[model samples]
Target: MSPRNDIQNIKVREERKRQIMNVALEIIAENGFANASVARIAQRAKISKGLMYNYFESKEDLIINIMLDGFNQLTLSFDTNKDGVLTEEELHYFIDSSFETLKNNIHFWRMYFMVLLQPQVYEIITPYLEKTLQPFYETAINYFIDKGYEDPIAEMRFFAAMMDGVGLHFILDPDNFPLDGVKKKMHRMFK
Candidate 1:
C-alpha cells in the first residue's frame, strides 16, 4: 500500500478500536461486566462480533484497554505540565480536573468501582494499576515533602484517602452532593 493509504488505514483502525471500547464501556457500566458479553457490546456498537474480535482478543482485553485509556486520560488531566513534578497550582488543577471528570463521566467511574469490587477483575488489573498509578503516588509524596510537611507520607496518604472518599460520595449521590462547595473547601485546605 502507498504511504498515504497506510496512514488512512491506521486512522481508520484507531477510530474503529475507539468505537468498540466506548461501546464496551457503556455496556459494562450499565449492565455490569458479567453481562457485557461480546455479542452485547457488538450489538451496541452496531458492528459484527467477528469485527469486534478483529479489534480485541476477548472481553477481558477490551475492558483492560478501556481502563488503561481512561486512567491515562485522567492522569494527563492532573498533569498540566508533562514535567512529572507537581506544583501547588498543578495540585489544585488536579483536584479540580479530577472532580470534573468524575462528575461528568459517572459511567466510567461506575465501571471502575464495579471492576474494583470484583476480585477476578481486580486481580487481572492489579499490575496495570500499579504501573499507571505509581508515578502519581510518588509525585504526591514528593510534593508534600517539598512543602516542608512534618510527615510527608502521612499527609499524602490522608489527602489521597480523602479524595477517594469524596469520589465515592460523588459517584453515589451526584445529584444531591454539593460537589462545587466541597471542591472550594478542599481548595482552601490544600492551598
Candidate 2:
C-alpha cells in the first residue's frame, strides 16, 4: 500500500477504536464494569462483539485502555511547557487544570475508584497506573526545581501525596471536602 493509503487506514482504525472506547465508557458508566459485558458494549457500539476483539484482546484490555486514555486527557490539560521556569500563575494553572479535569469526569473517576476496589482489576491496572502517572510526577518535580526549590523531588512527592489524599476525599464527599480551597492552598505554596 502507498504511504497515503497507509495513513488513511491508520486513521480509520483509530476512529473505530475511539468509537469503541466511547461506547465502553457509556456502558461502564451506566452499569458497573463487573456487569458491563463485551456483548453489551458491542451492542451499544452498534458493532459485533467479534469486531471489538479485533481492537481489544479482552474486557480487561478495554478497561485499561479507557483508564489510560483518561489519564492522558488529564495530563494534556496541564501546561507541560517546562522551559526551566515555573511562575506562580503557571502553578495555579496546573492545579486548576488538574482539578477541573477530575471534576469534569466524575463518572470516569467513579469507575476508576470502583475498579480499584476490586483486587483483580487493581492488580491488572497497577502497572499501567504507575507508567501513566510517572511523567506527571516528574514534570511536577521539575517545575518545583525550576522555581528554585532545594529538594524539589522530596517536596513534590509530599505535595503529590497530599493532593491525592485530598482529591480522593473530595471525590467521596464533595460537599464536605471544600475543593475550592485547593486553589488557595496551591497559591500559598507558591507565595
Candidate 3:
C-alpha cells in the first residue's frame, strides 16, 4: 500500500476502535460490567462480533481501556502550580475539578465504584489504578516534604485516604451531603 493509503487505513482503524470503546462504555453504563457482553457491545456498535476481537483482546481489556482513559482524563484535568507546589487555592481547585469530573461522568464513576466493590473486578484493575494514582500520591508527599513537614509520607497518605473517603461519601449521597465543607474540615485537621 502507498503511504497515503496506509495513513488512511490507520485513521479508519482508530475511528473504528473509538466507536467500539464508546459503545462499550454505554453498554457497561446501562448494564453493569458483569452483564455487558462482547456480543452485546459489538451489536450496539453495529459491528460484527468477530471484529471486536481485532481491537480488544476481551471484555476485560475493553473495560480496563475505559478506566484507563478515564484516569488519563482525570490527570489531565488536574491543574497544579508551575513550581510543582500546590497552594491552598490550587488544592481547592483540584478537589472541585475532580468532583465535577466525577459528577459529569457519573456512569463511569458508578461503574468504577461497583468494580471496586467486587474483589474479582478490583483485582483486574488494581494494577492500572495503582499506576494512575502513583503520580498524585508522589506529588502530595513531595509537596509536604518540601514544606519541611515531618513524616511527609504518613501525612500524605492520611490526606489521600481522607480525600478518597470524602469523595466516596459525596458520590453515594450528593443530595444530603455537603462536599464543599470538606476543605474546611481538612483545614481544621491541620490546626
Candidate 4:
C-alpha cells in the first residue's frame, strides 16, 4: 500500500479500537464486569465479535487496558512539583485536579470502582496498579517524613484512607456531595 494509504489505514484501525474500548467501558460501567461479555461489547460497538477479537485478545485484556488507561488519565491530571515531592501547593493542585477528573469522567470512575470491587479483577491488573500508584504513594510517605511526622508510614496510610473516603462519597453521591467543601477540608488535613 502507498504511504498515505497506510497512514489512513492506521488511523481507521485506531479509531475502531477506540470505538470498541468506549463501548466496553460503557457496558462494564452500566453492568458489572461479569456482565460485560465480549459478545455484548461487540454488539454495543456494532461490530462483529471476530472483529473485536482482532483488536483485543479477550474481555480481560479489554478491562485491563481500560483500567490502565484510567490510571494514565489520573497521573496526567495530577501535577507533581519538579522535585518529585508533594508540596502543599502541589497537594491542593492534586486534590482539585483529581476532583475535576472525577467530575468529568464519572462513568469511567464508576467502572473503575466496580472492577476494584471484584476480587478476580484484582489479579489481572495488580502489576499495573502497583506501578501506577507507586509514585504517589512514595511521594506521600516522603512528604510526611519530611514534615517530621511520627510514624510517617501510618500518616501516609491515613492520607490514603482520607482520599479513599472522599472518592467513595463523591462516587456514591456525585450529584449531591459537597465536593468543594470536602476539598477544602482535605486541604486543611494535609496542610
Question: What C-alpha lDDT values do all the predictions have?
Answer: 0.84, 0.77, 0.75, 0.81
- Please give each candidate's TM-score: 0.85, 0.73, 0.74, 0.83
**How much is the lDDT of residue 145 in candidate 2?**
81
Candidate 2, residue 164: the lDDT equals 66
Q: Pick the candidate with the highest TM-score.
A: 1
Model 3 lDDT per residue over 1-191, tens place:
54668888899999998888878877766676788899999998998999899999999998788777767666654446546566656666666677777767766666566555566556778899898888777777777787678898998888777867876787777777776677567766653
lDDT measured at residue 73 in model 1 versus the true structure, 0 to 100: 68
lDDT of 1 by residue, 64-176 (tens): 78778877866776657868788999999988898989988897787677665567666777788889888888888899999999998899889888888898888888889
Span of 10 residues, lowest total lDDT, candidate 4: 74-83
Question: What is candidate 4's CA lDDT for residue 1?
Answer: 50
Q: Over the stretch 1-191, how does candidate 2's per-residue lDDT look in tens digits?
A: 54668888899899999999878877766677788899999988889999999999999999899778866775674555755344566667777887887688766676556555566666777899998888777777887888788999998888777766766776787667778887678668766
lDDT ranking, best first: 1, 4, 2, 3
Better of 1 and 3 by lDDT: 1
Model 1 segments beyond 4 Å from truth? 1-4
**Given candidate 4, what's the lDDT at residue 128?**
79
Residue 74, candidate 3: alpha-carbon lDDT:
61
lDDT of 4 by residue, 1-191 (tens): 54668888899999998888788878877787777799999988999999888999999888788878877776664446446777877777878888888888787787677776677677778987888888877887888898899898899888778877887789889989999999989888877
